[model samples]
Target: MATENNVLLTDTADGVVTLTLNRPDQFNALSEALLAALQDSLAAIAQDDSVRCVVLAANGRAFCAGHDLKQMRANPDQRYYEQLFAQCGRVMQSIVNLPVPVIAKVHGMATAAGCQLVASCDLAIAADTAKFAVSGINVGLFCSTPAVALTRNVSAKKAFEMLMTGQFISADDAAAQGLINHAVPLDQLDAQVDALVQTICAKSPVAVRTGKGMFQRQRVMSLGDAYDYAGQVMAQNMMAEDVAEGIDAFTQKRHPVWKGR
Candidate 1:
């Protein structure tokens, strides 16, 4: 994925995979090829057992400005727009559906669907100077799709306000609004992201994967149904070798050596 002029670049180290958006000149806009690349990479990561975590980073000064507006203007077809939005939605859902956690390493600005990318992630860490917005309305278009992910991550009123006003918020405000996990100095952004990645990598991969799937599925369930489903999941988790090893390690006052991912 690191080929010359590749729209997406990928690197893996220490059970962590970093996927970098490579459209620097275009501010990492999610063009058609870029969207396809993202979907393909995420699909592959879903099956890769060695990948304990994923970091979504960008190469440019701007994280992502959103969809490729020029491309959209070139087509100007309703059907094409429908398919494009659908594809973008799948990419967002793919992030939420991936077995391992995805952390957005945000810098500069992330607006519209770019901000949706941050929302789709399980966690996000942004530089203090980074900015976020759902600014489709500024162009006379509504950010209907980004609103889906945004509202799920942030309060309904705040999400609506961003959509309506087309205003940007600083990274710290994004964190306070629940759109991102933390915002640190630009120089320390990588360190903060790495600290979180290391923490996740230290946990049992089996438990992490199982919990992620269950957490997503049970969110839409009724209270009683959610409890029932969680109980079943926990019961099954107890049977995993890693769980047994973890309990044994706790009793023995030692670190657990996980057996399965």
Candidate 2:
């Protein structure tokens, strides 16, 4: 039997944990319930060292259509929008800051905050039929929340174009712009993501954690400071048992047994 969490379906096996957003009828839009569910899921996974990798997917035609517009329309008040966007920001931050690697599995349209969700992941793979957009501008509302992650993933000029035009872009364009890693046929989406996850999950979890953390933290630092910070991290990682075992295994020509230290 599958153990399901509210707003999400979670399954753990082979060092990989898959978390699927469950509101397919709404294209898995982010509502208060979905946000709360995701927050708790991330927090729980953070505590489980056995979870070496995370696959963020959804059960829907569209991976995510962005924030629940119905909720936004009902609220109307600026304060409601502020609070909702704030929660979206927090969820994105959690995904990026989480210790384990997160891979976004996108199969269809991922617009507005949905695009932000894809960008927030450490890596993303989309299907050939997939489409992406930041179309909030079409409705006279800028996709400010999405801009936060999109700008970091794509070049400044490219990101601005997407935000300003709100035009839909194909999966190929997303990968070329660095917003997504790979794009394959819809039929191959699962295999593609699974292979990518396997490639990452085979690595030493400790090293992966250190590398992911360093990568996330160094993005905004000055070049010199970034190098210095990375050096310190390298030194610290070197002293960890996992690193020592890894090195020894290389010399002995044997598979490394990671202790997750």
Candidate 3:
């Protein structure tokens, strides 16, 4: 659905929600209004059990160009900057906190906070022509905010190189550095993203939701703690009716009918 201003467009089908960033003329920069819209959309989707997956896509020549530089300059104050970054951070974290999986579909340049957006998603599929960079340094900023998610997705050395040098990396390099899941030709970008979405949608929703949460939580834990947490999650998952159905169907050589318990 198109927002009042049409800055963001959303469409849902087959249990998948597609959130498309509009404002192509501005390279889909994250203006305050756009951020608010996105925040609201994510919040709504989080509560919508019907949504099994979300695709974060964009229109125009660039996926996103980071924060609105003009708007930033317009209000050059410490408090304003702090609030803006905080708002952006909330939006990014919402994606991680969402029970369902989120996939970034990148087809053009994604810079600064844009790159951060890609890093924040659980999965990212970029087109061969897509480019990524944390280029805030080029404009006298340090990309400190974007670095939060960027550091988590890639190695410290590689993340620092991009943040400090403000250089762009090809989609293939992004995938190699673990910043994205895969890089395909521009023509296949949609199909590749859809394929992943379909795969996730085919799974039991309850299992996928539990697994996604466990995956994120374990990432920040010690190895031993991770295993402990994982074991608990597995035990809980086994108690779900879907698990029994899945096992029985497997042994019986029949397709499992998931109740999403």
Candidate 4:
């Protein structure tokens, strides 16, 4: 377990690393410091083979309120804004580039960049009472950065509506719209997330890694290229020791003893 800058906290157990945004007072806003902390943590996790899964969880009443407006306003310079956004973009990209999958555990408000964080994750689960929006439009600023991730998860029209209208949607609505995987009662949120984590952790690490990497990369490729690439990935996956064990165990009617990494 580790806490950095008192803005981010990390704990790992049973191969799952939970990175918690610790700024409860600010609704866990993406302050510059917090973004830097996340970047560092993510980089470290990318190289950590011991970690099989990541849970992007947060503390406090709101999951996140987006950028630290006060901090941004304090340095109201074009150069500052450009650098700030670029930094934020890198952090988001890092999440997508991570070898292991990340699951966002959302509660309360997840607005603007907060919502982007959820969308950037490989999977997300939210409390039914949670609310989400790309509400920068209300402040006369289009959520351009958030849009990149949002549009990838949601339909163009639906994502545009959220960006243009700045209207909050319920967690169930978010799930239905594909912004989140599931929305459960607040009390059941942890259980649901834990169940999902366990389900993923039970699989062969090599298969999970190979599949996640190929899944994202193949999305942007042409249909023919995608199939050709997927075939290569699958062929490589078949060569893993765990795959052999997995098939053998299935044939023998026994649980697989996974040793892949």
Highest TM-score model number: 4
For model 3, what is the error of residue 123's alpha carbon versus the real structure, in angstroms, after optimal superposition? 0.4
lDDT of 3 at 134: 97
> Per-residue lDDT of 1-261 in model 3, one digit per residue for the tens?
444449889998888989999989999999999999999999999999888999999999999999999999999899999999999999999999999999999999999999999999999999999999999999999999899999999999999999999999999999999999999999999899988998999899989999989999999999999999999999999999999999999999999998989
Q: Model 2: runs farther than 4 Å from truth?
A: none
Model 3 RMSD in angstroms: 1.1
Give Cα distance to truth, residue 255, candidate 2, Å. 1.5
> How close is every model to the real structure, measured as TM-score?
0.97, 0.97, 0.98, 0.98
Model 2 Cα lDDT, one tens digit per residue, 1-261: 246866788888887888898999999999889998898989988888888899999997999999999988989898988889999899999999999899999988999999999999999999988999999999999999899999999999999999999999999999999999998999999999988888888888889999999999999999999999999999999999999999999999999998989
Q: Which has the better TM-score: candidate 1, or candidate 4?
A: 4
lDDT string, candidate 1, 1-261, tens digits = 343239999988887989999999999999999999999999999999988999999998999999999999999999999999999999999999999999999988999999999999999999999999999999999999999999998999999999999999999999999999999999999899999999998899999999889988898899999999999999999999999999999999999999883
- Model 2 TM-score relative to the real fold: 0.97
lDDT of each: 0.94, 0.92, 0.95, 0.95
